[model samples]
Target: MIIGYVTNFNLNQLDFNIKLKIQSDKFISSNCRKQYVKYLLDFEFRKNFHCIGIPIIKDPPKDSFVIGHHFFNDQENRKIGSYIFSYCFEKRHYVNLPDFTFNTLLILSHPKSGMLHFKDRNKRILFIKPKPKYISLCTSREDICGPIFMKQKANIIKKIDIEVDDNCEIGDNCICKNKTLKESENDLKFIYFVPKNTN
Candidate 1:
């Protein structure tokens, strides 16, 4: 299950869209998949914004889970962000967003979780499980700022300070910040993923 917002910031208006994708090998029949997709298409977490999910015929790789957000623009965006935030909180997961709103891929996943290969080695990537209060701050804004802000204001979510290693892999259920990949000299692109224990 993946959910996040995509933003297109223009001079006059901002195009905010919510997207979701659920890949499973258990959808046995095409009709079942189509119906599930239809359900997601019709389901509205907010009044006017509906989640968009593309159904695939082929099975996705195992233990796939990816999450991130782009930007928030209005009450609708906040509502959707809050929805995703609440879901993550209930499941004890984390959410991270960039510092600014730009054209970027917001979600990535694979069935078999291991080292992920990327064409762009210089891409800056950081993974952190922000404190719960900070997660709430992310869903209350209607502007073009990332989760980390320079100045603390009524709407700004302040930047979190934490020490990070040059390059390290974060384990499941760990809480840390600034574990960045861009700081490493080695071509390290792998993000190991262990399936969450549902039991």
Candidate 2:
């Protein structure tokens, strides 16, 4: 089933393309069962971005699966990033296992954003919130510090009442702050389901 849609395009063709990529992957073919393989395709038309997450498992348990998110820049025809993760069903919510690569930890450190994918037969995309432990790991990386600081700068400015230069404008450069920013809490609502048809 198609989890998301694109306007003015043949979904069958899009589905075919997704399947073709999976079929061509020898590792997925050799390790995962074709019949059980599921695809979560997300298209950000404004960004010209296409992301496909495939759960690669040889024999997935009824309540858990391992997935890898593959993101691509459609305009550039290049991959942006690919990160693998494992999730398991618990207390009616899917919990992310801590098994993550260093790069994956960096991506998760960004505030209020996490990986989205289809992990079940539901018609909504499962949004896995970033764990605080993972976010802390990113602070030690000098390269990622700049981008993360920039992304959260607006919030910092607000809290500190810092004055900005009149010449500065809030846009992609400065104003894009995390909408869901809140005090660090262990019980913050994490699991979110974005309806497939909303976009």
Candidate 3:
């Protein structure tokens, strides 16, 4: 879907000097105009410069800049036809919000979680949730840490345990490829830990 932020101003309301970039299948609608106004006045959301929208179309470009949905339909109800993502970078700096909103059918191809976990300088663990429609990897590293993965500038040392289904794959290029296992219906429920966790 075309994901981007929105504001209270209409196409005409915006000052001429202020520039907005609207991508394909994304536009401002009349139904949410007033809601955008109230959002601008809201104290809780004041810290956020841009208010995002969940577009109708599915599979929008990465980091596509968009605006002008005005007000979100239901901000309090976190699950309103929208998916929420929380991302943590360098063991800290968490970013969470509605991915994107626009005026087209939003067919979520991947159910991947935007959140990720990393260990050591070159080691990392990625958690993904897949959607029914698409087969591509749901989560991308850039979405969490921009373009490059830099370390040492900050010391991030933390440990956490995560659960996953037996059918899950680490990723096509994942170092954990050799760790894959095959289990039949007779396999018992269990948990396995990597060397890092055993330490």
Point to the candidate with the largest lDDT. 2
Instruction: Give per-residue CA lDDT, model 1, range 47-78, as digits (tens).
Output: 22322222232432233222232222245423
Q: Give the clash count for model 1.
A: 4
For model 2, residues 1-199, the per-residue Cα lDDT tens digits are 5566767766553322221112123233335422122222232222322222333345555664433232323333322333232333232222233322212111212233333222221222212222211111111111111111111121111111222234423343231132332332221111222222233
Candidate 1 RMSD to the correct structure: 19.8
Query: Can you tell me which runs of candidate 3 are displaced by over 4 Å?
Result: 1-14, 25-164, 169-199
Error of 1 at 142 (Å): 13
Tens-place lDDT digits, model 3, residues 13-122: 33334322332232233343211111211212211122223334244334522222212223343322212222233223222222344432222221221112222211
Q: Which segments of model 1 are wrong by more than 4 Å?
A: 1-135, 139-157, 170-199
Error of 2 at 113 (Å): 22
TM-score, structure 1 vs. true: 0.17
Q: What is the TM-score of each candidate against the true structure?
A: 0.17, 0.23, 0.17
